[model samples]
Target: METLANLESFIRSAEHGSFSEAARWLSLTPAAVSRNVAMLERNLGVRLFHRSTRKLTLTEAGESFRLAISDSLSGIQAAIAGIAGDGGEPAGVLKLSLAPTFGVAHILPLLPGFLERYPRIKPEWHFENRQVDLIAEGYDVAIGGGFDLSPTVVARTLAPAHVIAVASPGYMADKTPPREPADLQAFRGIVMRSLQSGRVRHWTMRDVTGREAPVRLQESFVVNDPSAMRGAALLGMGVAMLATADVLADLENGALVRLAPRWYSDAGAISMYFPSRTLLPAKTRAFIDWVVNAFEAEKLAERFAGSLDLRSSRSG
Candidate 1:
């Protein structure tokens, strides 16, 4: 049988990466949390962490324990809430982190309807270009775009971008249009870094064999910001490769043109991600449902191919 105190400590510690962070959340000193975990380990007779100089990693036992405890705690919380009527209405603070462009492009704009629909639920937004771990960073929800996610954290697709190649009319005016992936090698190549790997992901196209064909980089420019890359492409700085949502307006307005040779990129869906809804607070559930509905109602399917620059003039 798991002791309730030990379970609580484990959950809190897992939710916050640092002992100090867990302590702060639990209103206990770091020493106290560490001591509690130590005793719990003694009781179980197992090592939980692989201690090292650089970073903390979980052993197999620790990983299994964490997952078990998460489910157990969720069950307990649901039971308690079942009696307390916490699931009756939406009411609480939802802490969230999101990419800057997403926050501005999708969430922030559509927030008015969500807030109006659920006045009782207040969401605190943290918009940054960095990846936020929901459990480790004390965030209730995180909006992210990537091919995959961490094992410890849970996520749902909110919005994913359709990958596409774009360049400004200003840049393409005098140059020959690229009709193939290798053709980009002759032109100045722009690169964007992946937030997950900290490595630059080459703008790749697909081959008839359904294999990834990488676009050659001529080293024209490199940038981390998708929005800025669009701007650079607009200024004729270089060929900008990004999500279709990043340049839908420019493409439509003739400021930018498609670099489609091999039918290069497709739009990726945006998804709303969180830890778990098994024992979700009413507020969080309500907001999640509302956001999903709003996403559909607003015809957000066209989010990738439309001009988001219209946002400066109108709010969607």
Candidate 2:
């Protein structure tokens, strides 16, 4: 009989298309994943993937097996959730994937209060800078940003906060602040790009007076994450355009300054999305409520006003 270990490894490998990627998804070593696949192959007497230098390709037998068993596995998962309801709340391990920065800046602070409210929902946080496949990875929920989630998932918007154009106090002293969006081309800046969004970070901004039109920026560095780009700006590397929440503490301490607030468009929204289904566990629903309320109770909306406002903490 094929062991569960072998079956799981094969499924992950097929989903990821590489042993290393599958291992990363499972929090295991590539060698361990390879071993599991090998064990499965030995039991079934069939090669699953045709390994080659170019790329891994699923064999005919492998494709058929995936189609047959994937839904069965999902049904098994639903059964587990049903059984875990004996506690009368969310009683299963929840695998949550999120951006590392958002996880730190927002979710971590909110968690203590949330945990105090619900003792039954134990959360396992997975922090990654990359987008994860919820279905393939079996994640219960994920916190995403500026993303249009797949049709299979139900995305819920929690709070939308404006992004601000910001720079360090030191950088502003050396570089004259751009009087308007067009002047951004004259200053050094950073751009944050991700798999989910566009790369027009330095392009333009607007107010009630219609769009300011397109403009180019003198980018000194380009990074894949907002937090990393913000760190570079904090070290006086260059200016950065960031979400209000991401730099709330620094702006409060006068470490960073927002420039010409009128030149910025509304950006940055905190959101939580989950797989679309008829039956959601009570624990999951409780968590969603706890988190949304926490943000509202903390006056997360008010924080945005002063986050990168280039003003003193006293004003906040």
Candidate 2 colliding pairs: none
Whole-model lDDT, model 2: 0.73
Candidate 2 wrongly placed segments (more than 4 Å) = 1-87, 193-201, 266-268, 305-316
TM-score of candidate 2 versus the correct structure, residues matched by position: 0.65
lDDT by candidate, in order shown: 0.69, 0.73
Model 1 residue 308 CA deviation (Å) reads 18
Q: After superposition on all CA atoms, what RMSD does each candidate show versus the true structure?
A: 13.0, 13.6
lDDT for each residue of candidate 2 in 1-316, tens digit (9 for 90 to 100): 5666677788889998889888998889999999999888878888889997655679999999888878877787687667776656656577888877767887888788767777766889999866677877888778866656788877777665566677888877856666566766677878765555656455456654665645465677888878888899899877677777778778778888776555665655667877766567776777777777877887766676423343442211
**Tens digits of per-residue lDDT for model 1, 89-119:** 6777889887776577667876887788788
lDDT of 2 at 61: 95
Best by lDDT: 2
**Model 1, global lDDT:** 0.69
